[model samples]
Target: MNRNQHIWLSVFFSLALGLLLWKLKLPNLFIYSLPMYPTAILPDFIEPALDPNHRKFFHSKRMFKFLVICLVILLLLASFKSQHYFFWFFGVLGYLLHLIAESLTFKGLPN
Candidate 1:
């Protein structure tokens, strides 16, 4: 699918996640939905400036793994009476969802 389609899908995913969190009485309601859509597509915006190969570098398996580990660790570290945990948690969620969707595209994903 195209970028717009991917974006809408990501937004839908994010919103659903947010609603689930809200229903479960999780802290920071809609936090993931708010910034996740943009966060999910950020690589598409930055890839041109960062690399000619685009998604290959930014969306690489290694990068995704590292990002997930770092975000989860940071989220856990900041979870205790800290508001910043929301940013990290939502960012990670959005990024993961974006990559998962992108994997289905013709572009596929890097190693």
Candidate 2:
């Protein structure tokens, strides 16, 4: 799918998640879901222009792991410094949506 498709799909997914998690602490996944629409295309620009494995780098498991680490680090740092939970949670959800959107293209993290 293209950028527009990814954006619409991510928006839909985020809507569902937001409703499902409405009672939870982070109910506003939709607020931060915008990041996924653009970030989902990062791999295409960063990877070789004509490379077949274009989505490998940004959508791969390593990238997901790195995002997890970043999230953890952010949470840990939040203990010491003031952090806006809304954006942080939105960013985390957006990152996951980026991965999920890629998977929809049948590019489920490099083998």
Best-performing candidate as measured by lDDT: 1
Residues 1-111, model 2: lDDT tens digits: 555666676677767777765757654445554454555455555663364466666668888788878777766765566545545655665666666666666546774
How many clashing residue pairs appear in each of the predictions shown?
0, 0
* lDDT, candidate 1, 8-101, per-residue tens: 9887887678778888997465653477877777767756324434676777788778877977786777676676677767777777777777
Give the best candidate by TM-score.
1
Q: What local distance difference test score does each model get?
A: 0.72, 0.62
Identify the runs in model 1 with alpha carbons over 4 angstroms from their true place: 48-54, 81-83
Q: What is the lDDT of residue 76 in candidate 1?
A: 77
Residue 88 error, candidate 2, Å: 3.2
- Measured with C-alpha atoms, the lDDT of residue 62 in candidate 1 is 81
